[model samples]
Target: MHSPEIDNMAKLWDLIGDIRLAMFTTRHHNGHLHSRPMTTQNSRADHDTKLWFFMSRHGSPVAELTGEASVNVAYANPGKDTYVSVSGNATVVDDVAKKRQLWSKSAEAWFPGGPTDPDLALVRVDITHAHFWDVHENKLVQLFEMGKAAVTGHPAPKLGRQGEVRMA
Candidate 1:
């Protein structure tokens, strides 16, 4: 469980845990942002404030991050009105042990040769900052708030809790 006073990374983990797919964005050589869906591998954020993903050694994500480490990963749970965006530096790790630790049978679908697959790449994103919005209120209440704000000509009322975490 996560509490208000819990470590921000843990709070981030709470928002994203069940939202398994994230739009992992990275910069391309031409300076445009590129994004692709990647599976979230961990059940919780570790104290080190890192997020992990497995990629193919031949994949663009591995090559792009190698050339430019900056990246953003976005997770959204529309049903829960929870969204999280993480900004970080990414590096392709060469640790076999770490790869083995994070590996799963599902991953074999991508890297058919298992953990020892020569094409399997382990990526570690060292979180520098994160922002999240979690709306616990029901849709009816949210609609009412927006309506009231529009009638009053004021900014939309805050829909729910918003927070930022800086780890760098």
Candidate 2:
């Protein structure tokens, strides 16, 4: 449970977990932004505001972040109509225990050496701020509301939720 008095990172974790994948964007030295799909390393632990990801140390994202840590991760679920955008500073760390903990058979396809692969690196994004949009009502109910509003010459009802989490 979360109270309005404090923004909870657990709630943010659940929201990000629901979406699963994030478009991790990083700035290149050429002053252009690049984005790549990344799977969030979801854990049961109540992380304050840090998100983890596994990637090859040789990857461009890792290289780019070495110079500038500022980055953004976007998550979207069109079917559920939920979306989130997070701004953070990413730092690469050599935490063998964490790599082992978050490891899975699926990751072996990328790093054949398994969790002990030297090329494999764990990047932690220290979230400074996060924004999310979600619809609470069922699809049918939301459609009905839209129809009603249209017939009454009124604006569409805002049936969802939106919030900003300043975690940093």
Candidate 3:
């Protein structure tokens, strides 16, 4: 990746690092979309577009993706006013290395047998593009900008940044 692309990917992580949970959405065979909150298994420092999550082997998400691989993962931080949407292809991964690598005690709540649990499966989403809105300003600054825009009858100043990242 070029410096600019690296920078953009880093920025994408910055917007999502503080948000641990993502609304992982998948399309069912019935043509309806379903979403569930899933915890990200990697940190921002990973610096990769691929995301991982642990799920039951027979879970609805696994079944849904087995039929349809396209998926979306959404991150939102209302307190920070940051939001991100990632589109990608997801699949039920069968990598024992990855399972042991990401395994933790917290996950035992769902997988009592730990990494060797037959019901445990890893879902990997290879992101194709990501759209993010990062508004890092404080409430005071945002209100001031909105006030100025209102007074001048002009659009509010976009103190933050928004853009798309194409990883594939």
Candidate with the greatest TM-score versus the true structure: 1
**Candidate 3 lDDT, 1-168, residue by residue in tens:** 468667766777877877879999999888999999998887544558788899998889999998899999999998988899999999888898888888877889989998889999899999888998878899999999999999999999787888887877
lDDT (Cα) of model 3: 0.87
> Best lDDT goes to which candidate?
3
After superposition, candidate 2 runs with Cα above 4 Å error: 1-7, 147-153
Error of 2 at 34 (Å): 1.1
Q: What is candidate 1's lDDT per residue for 1-168, written digit by digit as tens?
A: 664435776677777778879999999988899999998676443445888898989989998997899999999999999999999999988889888878888898999998889999889999888999899899999999899888999988677899897776
CA lDDT scores, all candidates in order: 0.86, 0.86, 0.87
Assess candidate 2 and give its TM-score to the true structure.
0.86
By TM-score, rank the candidates, best first.
Answer: 1, 3, 2
Better of 2 and 3 by TM-score: 3
Model 1 spans > 4 angstroms off: 1-6, 44-48
